[model samples]
Each structure stands twice: as C-alpha cells, then as structure tokens.
Target: MHLIKSNWKIALGVIPALLIYCIFSIIPIFISFYYSFMSWNGFSAMQYVGLANFKAILNDSVFWLSVRNNLIVVAASVFGQIPIALVLALLLNQKIKGAKFFRTIAFLPVVISTVVISLTWRLIFNVEQGLLNNLLDNLGLSALAQNWLGNPDYAMYAIAVVIIWQFVGLYFIIFLSALQTVPRDILEAADLDGATEWQKTRYVTLPSIWGVIIIAVILCISGSLKTFDLIYVMTGGGPANSTEVMATYMYTETFQGLRYGYGSAISVLIFVFSIVMIILANVLLKKRGNRKPV
Candidate 1:
C-alpha cells in the first residue's frame, strides 16, 4: 500500500494504458463469453442457446480435424523450430565469417509481409512451372516432385515446413540474445577446467537460457493454435480442409457461415486450448528443470 502510494505518479501514468487495454482487449473477452451462450446471425436477434454451440462443436468432425491439424502445428513449432533455432543461434554465436549477413538473411522472412511470403511460396509449390518441380526434374528426381498445396496428404506438411522456415529466425534471434547474456567468466572457468565445447554448451550455455527456451516453447504453442494468416493466404484451409486450423475454421464459421455465436464459442475454445497447453508446457519444463543432473 505504501509503495503504491509513494509511486502514485507512475500509477497515474499507467491508468490510461490500462483503461485502453480494458476497453479493447479485456472487455471483448467478456463480450465473447456472453455471446458464446447465444445463437445469432449478425442481422437477427440473439437467441439464448446455452451449450448448443459447444455441443455442436463436440460432434463436428471438421472441427476435430482442425484440432488435429492445430496439434501438428504446435508439435512442429516446438520440436522443429526451437532446436533448429537454438542450433543456428549457437553456430552464429561463434566467430564465423558472414555471420551477420547470414543472420539477416535468416530473419528476412519474419520482416516480409505474410501475404507476400504466402504468395511467393504458393508459386513455388505450383504444380506447373514451379521451382520445386523444375529443380526435381533437372536433378532427375522428378518422381519426388509433388502437388504440394493441392494434395491433401502433402498440403499440411508443406505448410508446416513454411511455418518453420518463417518463424525459426525469430526464435534464433531470441536464443542468440539469451546466449549473449550468459556469463563469460563461467565459460572461461570451464575452459580452465578442460571442459570440451559440447560439455560447456550442455552444462553452462543451455542452462543459462533454459527459462527463455521455456518461454519460447509457450509462445510457439500459443502462436500455432491461432495461426491463420499464412495458411489462410497459402491454402485458405482448402485441399479438402487438410490445412485448416482453429482460427481459419472460426473465421469461416462466423463470417461465411453466419454463425456468430458459434464462432465466439470456437474463439473461447482457442483461448482454453492455449491456456491448457501453456500450463502443461510450464509443468513439464519445470519438472525437467528441477531434475538432478545424473
């Protein structure tokens, strides 16, 4: 109480931002929650439907397929992006030639607009006159060339690869920043004790950034759950709904299908899924962190 009173000026300065956040973010969550219990098209009166929307979702096979695809995305981001990013960060942390140029090139996708990336990749994946198929033909591996986005079996995996390529750079920068914060003195001491490079990385370097890694995992999971723009632009959740995710499905249901209340319910499910996954990740990571070194 005394601390807040002493810092009243800071509190006053924070109030406006807090109010803005409440109006835009916090308030809408409650509004969505209320709307989830009703059924309404945008033009019609809202009818109180209780759990009808959620009940329908339970029996909806398409929604379940979206859920499965979302889980695949989360798995790919966590398992593929994090390790690849960490390895890149480690390699770049060393005194390597053209490290800065390589870093910039890797991060270029992150800064590029998603629409542009999607369009470009879509072209590369095109069945006719696409770079991938052309390369395969030139290399005498024409049989390996695929329909990519047009084929249901390959569509989701192809999207997953692009997702990894785009976001790996972001986590790479994050891990590199965390790596720089590790104490050099400890590393020097480890060197004095004749520690090999791998040993030092396993013990000192990774432990220093373990918390950041956990946060990255949580971010990856959250981002994967709500992934829409890139996949939407590339496939529009088509190829027989193979690439559909929760957010894209929700968009279709609410806007195109005119099931606003049902969309709200889907949004609520996304929120719940994010919260649960993050909590599970934290619990699992905490347990790993607490384990005694063998």
Candidate 2:
C-alpha cells in the first residue's frame, strides 16, 4: 500500500500510454489469437476448427520451404548484415574526414521506401535488359548473366541481398550509436599500451557494445520472420515458392488462398521460433559478457 502510494504519480503518468497500447497492440493481438481458431475468408463468416489447421501446417511442404527460406534470411542477416554494419560503424567511429556524412549516406537506403528499392532492384535483375545483365554483357561476361528472379536457385539469394542492402543502414546506425558510447579512456589506455588497432577493437570496442549486438541479433531474427513488403513486391514468393518466407506464405494463405486458420498457425510458429531464438541469443550474450576481460 505504501509502495503503491509512492509510485502513484508514475502510474498515473503511464495511464495514457497504457491505454494507447491496449487500443493499438493488445486488442489486435487478442483478435488475431481468437481468429486463429477459425476459418475465415475476410468478408465471410468464420468457421471454428480446433487444431486442424495447425496439423495441416505441420504436414505442409511449401510451408516448410517458407520456414527454410526465413531461416536462411535470418542467418544472412545475423552473419552478413550485422558484421558489415559493425565494420562500417567502426570506420565511421574513427576520426575520419566526413565521417558523419558517410554515416548519413550509408543510412539513406534504410529511410528510402522499400517499394522503391524493390522496384529498382527488380529492374536491375531483369533478364532481358536489366542494368546488371547489360553491364555483364558489355564487359564480355555474358555467360554470367542469368535470370535472377525467374530462376529458383538464385531467386532467394537475390532477394536476401536486397533485404540485406535495404536494412544494413539501420544496423549501421545501431552500431554507430553503440560505438559512440565506448569509453575514450579505455581506448587511449589501449593505445598507450602499444595495442594494435585490431587488438584494441577486438578487446575493447567489441566488449563495450555487446548489448547492441544482442539487440541487433533479436531484431534480425524477428525482422526475418515478419518480412513482407519488399518480398511481396519483388517476387510475390514466386519462382516456384523458392523465396517464400513465412510472412509471404502466411499472407498468401490468408488472403489469396482464404486459409485464415492455417495462416494463424504459421504466425504462431513464427512467434514461437522468434521467442526461442531470442532466449538463446540472450543466454549466449550473457555468457559472452561474463567471459569478457575484467
């Protein structure tokens, strides 16, 4: 009772925010959860079916393919996007000329509309006369020119590159923010100790921003699971479902195929997978942080 009275002001201040959260997030989540047990074609009456949809999803080959693609995208984001972003952040964190300008330029892609990038890359990857193929042909590398979107083997990878290019700037910004907080004293001490640049970075810089790394890993995992727009615009999960992430597959099932229950099952699976990854990442990060030099 005493604690509640003491914190009443703060609780009162949070009331509006709590209300907004309830309206926007909580309500919709509950609705989705409720709809998950039903079969509905958007405008039609919903038919409640217990775990049938989930069972069906478990047996779905294309669904599994979508899951596989999502995992691949997540792996690429974790390994490729973040490492490149960290490298860029490290470069920008140094006392280089026009570092701020370079940071802004790198981040410009993130702010640019995904639809625009999708359309632009779609043209670049065009089989007939796209710039990529055209350049390759001009340089006498015509043999390297192949159908990027039309081919099943290369389609997912191509989309993954686009995804990476589009969001690398976001991660770059995250890394830059973390890099900015590294203690100058530690760095100066390392320099005074005759530590090589790589040695200083490996020992000092990486340790300081571990929290950011963990957050980036979580974002990568969740973003990969929920990716929709760019892939929606680029391939529509096409080329024989080769590029079908769970998001795309779920969208197709719910809206196109009129399988709301099944779509919900996919969403649930994605939610579960994301939760598992986040928990695992947290464990790993905590262990790494504990093992850091005291």
| Highest TM-score model number | 1
Per-residue alpha-carbon lDDT of model 2 for 1-294, expressed as tens digits?
A: 989886998899999999999999778667767777888777778899988778888899999999899888988888889999999999888899998899999999999998999999999999998999999999999999999999999999999999888889999999999998999999999999999999998899998898889999889888888899999999999989999989899889988888777787788777888899889988997898779574
Which candidate number has the best lDDT? 1
Q: Model 1: per-residue lDDT, tens digit, 1-294?
A: 988886998889999999999999899889989999999999989999999999999999999999999999999999999999999999999999999999998788889999999999999999998899999999999999999999999999999999999899999999999999999999999999999999999899988899999999999999999899999999999989999999999999999999999999999999999999999999999889877655
Residue 192 Cα positional deviation in candidate 1, in Å, after optimal superposition: 0.7
Least accurate 10 contiguous residues by lDDT in model 2 = 28-37
> What 10-residue stretch in candidate 1 is worst by lDDT?
285-294
**Which pairs of residues collide in candidate 2?**
none
lDDT of 1: 0.94
State the lDDT at 262 in candidate 2: 75
